[model samples]
Target: MQPDLTVSRTYSGPICLQDPIDKELMTESSLFNPLTDIKVKVQSSFMVSLGVTERSEYHGKAHSGTFPHDSNRTFNPIHAKNKAAYLQNLSSLTKRSDMRTTGVFGHLGGRLGIPNTGVSLLIPHGAFSEEASWEIYLAINQSEPSLQLEGSEILLGPEVTCGPPEVTVSTPFALTIPHCAEVNPDHWTIHLKKKKEQGKWEEVMSVEEETTSCYCLLDPYACHILLDSFGTYALVGEPLSDCSVKELKVAVFGCMSCNSLDYSLRVYCVDNTPWAFQEVILDEKHQGGRLLEEPKLLHFKGSTFSLQISVLDIPPFLWRIKPFTACQEVPFSRVWRSNQQPLHCAFSLERYTPSTTQLSCKICVRQVKGHEQILHIQTSILENERDTITFFAHDDSHFPAQMGPQAFKIPYSIRQRICATFDTPSAKGKDWQMLAQKNSINRNLTYFATQRSPSAVILDLWEARHQHDGDLDSLACALEEIGRTQAHISALAETQTEESHFSYSRQNGL
Candidate 1:
């Protein structure tokens, strides 16, 4: 039988205990029951199904390239019968508080090169359950003492696993709002800080929510956080304050099927709040015309409700749906809006036929419309067994986004997931619309052409010819073509200018 593993919280080092009696109890069946003799086999089989071997060691061990069930040993009839039960137990184990993780924890090392409120990270939607409490531990070299002024303190254990070298002065900052927001900017000042090598945090200027210049807007209380080498950010505001007009918390998603018209919205309410919500559809292909729908007053007792909107009711081509909500309570009343922080889902619509091999999409989360922060990309692959639901997060600074004119970045470490079911799982069948939903909130990602930076990449024909000798002739020919193209552009410009002057004189009857 496999060793019955036990990890004691108090044990500082690896403790190898071989208690004969305990071992017998774990492996051998009780004398009172004869049919329960196969319990050990069932337990072992279940462990294999859950991929427990992959997470057996406190520090992740190198993968063996084969799972426990991948062995040549034949399974008994009883092991096969209890497989479903084993899978359920494995799922529970993953949710346990003490579950081990393989992620690297350390000081997020990097320097801030952009403006004070520049976005260094982006955490997209569908990353975690709406009810789950998530925390990301960051070890920076500096100390922003101002963060201690607002939210409650979180005490981290001195014993960090796979973290950076010890540093002086550690402060725990709260990511979520603790109480109602009765005050305005004073409620909680958002600080932009930089960590110096001498182990000190220097304060950067406060970001403007209304301006399109800021990087990202954070909802400190939200479960999502994107980390980078340069900095970490949290949303700090009273979103439901009396000074703000409440915006609806809604997620729009389209099913992946052969049908083009089917789509749905998941309306969210926190802890049974009474809400008045409305949706206004606008036609963009035709002259901007608003198609009004009756307002919905929902006393949401449940956490969420998935509502399907019929496509026949709205215009085709390009359309914008406006969703707004109002509530009477403390947390539900404060609805804040800024160019850097507008809550909406931007979906890229595509229709997939049955002949399509796979499903893929590029997902992002930005502060609002126009300002886009690329967060992640998802692509589905074919498999025999059903895909297990999973979530992944990382501090990838290379995520693709047009930060400024000519400034473009790409996804660093692309996170992957194989979900057993999507938000709209039934829409997975063929004949559905291929929609890539973008959940951008709390950051200005607007693109301005006039103030854009020059992204000119200089190329050297000599270096190209030397490095790629096989393409030397091709490189030489390309350079010649480029030189000729410049002359053609100059000639075209002169022709256009002469034609404009002649037309101007003719129109004025000069």
Candidate 2:
């Protein structure tokens, strides 16, 4: 029956936990329950899902291979499911040793790289009705002196899992914000000393947000292909130049454990190809381009990452000015957590763009012993002064599309500041894209390149490459380096010309 009298409820207040306890519950004995000691008790039928990390070393284990999931996908399901499972489990546990597997009695484990933050564990407890009452407490790690930082912002545990039977976590799982981790990467330790000093930070993980795409770009090459040691790459397409067509290629790489990743490439008709965040792969025919004369290779390793690709445009000896090759790799995997499921295993060739140049293209060819390679001989009557790039064609009807100079836009610049240094070509055969998203200081990458470099300016490029790609910081560094390199090269050329003139007079006994 409807209520005889109308009642008003406060709708202005946000759900919040008051006086959340901020200290770890000290167990009187080994047999004490952490929940009861902390004044939060749970019923026996109810289950609790605790957040745990099943370190490859912490607990005994075995089993390693390419993750069963697709290599081009990424997601953290353990933290996701645990949050869901916890809502149903609804009670806390005490046996840290027996909590690694699923089930209400087990602890939900996940891998958050290192320096994980935001304590968004699945708080498993439920309220049956308005009469059901209980309390939740969150206390800082009072035991760890280093964890207590002055002016640090941290959540002292919420009063309860304020979310409904389900909660949308801020990020499916917690991120190992550097400086907050107990273990550190060799690279992170040396370069991230400053960010770590910020002190301990904490967060509860019950929020779900999208993560940035890990867009892996690859460029194929023959004589100039840089990364040879870490073998992971693939080459495809015909050898010809069609100003309007943009053919495609792929590279595949594998990582340790059960993780593989793949990337989509957007091939262009010209020798130049800009790496971008793509969700699909492109095939040879659609783009008016073809493969090069050389074959590409793939390098594979069982885990941790590192590999590269090259895009080559080999114009014939002196006749047709076209590309010989332009293909990228498609990785088979990436880092995966213990409890997450992989994404699907399929990708596709999304689209194509024709050239907008002013020249009328021609289709000519040269036949060898048995195979025939198509070519476009420059017509003597037309005046062509632009710097053109590589040309290719995967097949006949596929790459007949022709493109021209104006079709290729002068891609603008970008910059980013990140955690590691960028690799220099001279350092380890790695090249830096005067325009790539990397730092110039790092020498460990497989392959990277840009126009050219001198010592001091190269250092600046290293910093630029090391900066996160596409961000303002890296772009700024790259721009400065480019200007410096051009200026230095120009000065050196002028100096040589003047010196040559003076030397000639001296030789004549002036």
Candidate 3:
């Protein structure tokens, strides 16, 4: 079929375009002016960002004493970025005053998407977080026709050069055809025929390149086109309705900014969902990973920053997982674990040479949405301990012996000195003889060892070293509680490292 022969210039008529805004309505009767006045208390701890969806559900303990309970649910996607309130109870843009409780009430809860409207009450955090709603992210879809201001081939004076209007660019940069002439697909190209030659312009000479426009950038959203001046300037936001570039100069922008993305992240423990963490912290109005929670700073000024923590060979310490305890070896896990009968990867850090377990990870991120996925390949440290413990976990019940609204949980597994203790043989000899028997027993450094629990003491050594009678034996305990774990292999302090990466598929038994 032949194309429509009839065509008109920009600014010559009007063209319809889609609106960029979305809207919704709410009832005021039930929310704005309730028949009875009421007040319900709400307390929030920290707020976390889940994925880019508007859901209102999360796990939380109930006031009525409930164990491992949760109310995971999805709510309508509402834009909660700086909206105003409309009621007392229904405290939202479209409020009815009649208060009703749903998801996270005593904590943080809300949906995602559209702008949020209401008196969002946030408790204090650090010194500044209380006032900030969110890090700003703007999606720009500047195209043609939308910002079209009539006309074509904008006639600038002899000295005026066209390019990006308000951008901070240096050399070799381009933008769309804006504030100048508008060109659309119907008119094809904006032919820039030099009118009068200052001096017969050479076909491929520098002067010829200065007056001819070559690069064009089309904005599909706004229906605008960008043009580069000769080879120096880039102008954008032109109404493609006009055909004015019959003479003079023109070009196009490479349209390179096709994949810029802005993102925000709400962190979560591996298997645990994300939003619940946010509500628990933000809703409780607690501090330090709790109410009034502070978001972890990930990337700043092109540099990434974050604290990577590993719960070492923590025993199945369930009691150490309390929310308000610190300064102790608590229970923990190494994978996406559930709240019930979760197992931890145990390990004797001393047995493994830095050869099997890979604690180091490389995060691969896609440029489009800035979405990142972490790649975990075992390092060389998890070797040798093949017959023993591997990963680490903190016991859950290790709640601290203190209590308060602002208590902090700082867990640490100290690597004390290595020591040895001997198991007293069932000796029924004289007191002196029993003592001598203990002394004569052996305690070897190279052999395996274990510590007695009730009055923890070192055990296991060679027999020859067992000399003096029991009480006055030689040094049997560890001389140093050295930090000999797989984590040390990944620490940045290594000035010189062995040049080998052990892979599972390698034949050398790495």
Candidate 4:
């Protein structure tokens, strides 16, 4: 199939060089108006460059939010070093009264393309002092995905030597192109050219090396073209007429939780333009995952975070499924039933590892004009424990804990002691027990070790040590009144840890 030829250019036109001395727009008053100013003799012509468009003679109304000016060579600025100097000079021009009056200056841009689109908002070097800064800031934050303008290009002088304006885009960069450009089969080669000293254009030396490129027409209104490089000789045709949303991708940012869930959604609109979704409708009907409210409505003013809803886990927890509130302050009320049941529940950090469940749903995003855009989004919801717990290897060195392939999520506190008791289990089950005996048993660390597999010996040691401590303090009246035996003491220690685990996980949203 033939590729589309969507061409964008910088339309340069001559403006009056000198402002009339008695023009009403040039008054000394602070309220300034340039439209009423009269033009005098042109000492030097000012060329204002609007983002250009080469449209088909047939389609008069181009698509909205598509920027064709980015494909133009005449509007490119130089590298960062030169751009900084140009910005500085431009700033000086605005500050100095003599520079404004000494020679003729022209307004370099106008409203030609779609209003509120990239081309309409983009002000080249000839526009204002902060225009360059704004472009740079916009490029970094990229607050809007649809309204992107290539930063100001260095305006060349007659004497300045120059090469072709080149932009090396990744092989899959151009997401969509206009329909008219696609009809011609010869427009696929990624052109490489340079500007000559005499103001003529010439092709750069093409390497015989077989470089690769990709072009995919998404639909009738949009086509994706990936080019290795582009130059002044490379021309595009009119953009596609209809605006569309090509695809939507969603992913879980961190951990999924039964208590609370977080998901990130990225909407890839057609033509790589920034678009604001008027309303996002989230429907949880017929889906295993349930929402606090059915058909949740979210509002956004051109922001990616259109819907961020969190709800407490509502389903009753099954046996063996640790609940988030399983702590001393709020004990887990386990139903005593022998029958096996599925327990896909999130729990306190001490009892279990948080679940990382992936959930997907198709959502409807409404545009400002009541147009409904449907998108499919898949997100991973993570309910991970958020403490940093470290274990020293046999060599007595702190090492990161790792499972088969992924790094283990650490708890809040650091545990870096050697469990020497593991060597001699005669009385103390593990090295951590012996260590706890010497350095008092901290309720939090001991409980953490108990939760993991093959670490029960470490937990036994902690229990033994705590019991020994409580036995020695039996003379206390409170201990006597509690009827706390060694077993009761062990439960107390467990309860203390459960309280700590609940507090830690809830605070950090692990």
C-alpha root-mean-square deviation, each candidate: 28.8, 31.3, 38.1, 35.7
Work out the TM-score per prediction.
Answer: 0.22, 0.19, 0.13, 0.18
Top TM-score hit: 1
Q: Mind giving the per-residue lDDT tens digits that candidate 4 earns over 385-405? A: 232212111111122111111
Per-residue CA lDDT of model 2 for 151-212, tens digit only, reads: 31211111111112222321111111111111112211111111121443332111111112
Error of 3 at 292 (Å): 7.7
Instruction: List residue ranges in candidate 1 displaced over 4 A.
Output: 1-205, 209-232, 238-241, 245-495, 500-510
Clashes of 2: 108
Error of 1 at 410 (Å): 6.5
Pairwise lDDT winner, candidates 2 and 4? 4
Residue-level lDDT for 364 in candidate 1: 28
For candidate 1, give the lDDT: 0.23
Residues 1-510, candidate 1: write the lDDT tens digits.
122334212222222223332243223322211121111111122222111121122222222321121344332212455656534433432222222121211121111111111112122222222222122222211122223323321111010111111211121111111111222353334444434446344443343444322222233212211112223222333222223212222222223323443222222221101111111111111322211111222221111222222222222333223333111111211122111122233232332333433333322222121122221223222223224321112222332221111111111110010011111223212000111111122233231111121010001112111221322233223222322343356568789999999999999998
lDDT of 3 by residue, 140-229 (tens): 111111222123322111111121112111111121111212233343233222212232212121111222222122222111111212
What TM-score would candidate 4 get against the native?
0.18
The TM-score that candidate 1 achieves is 0.22
The 10-residue segment with the lowest total lDDT in model 1: 410-419
**260: Cα error in model 4, Å:** 8.9
lDDT of each: 0.23, 0.21, 0.19, 0.24
Lowest summed lDDT over 10 consecutive residues: which window, candidate 2?
44-53
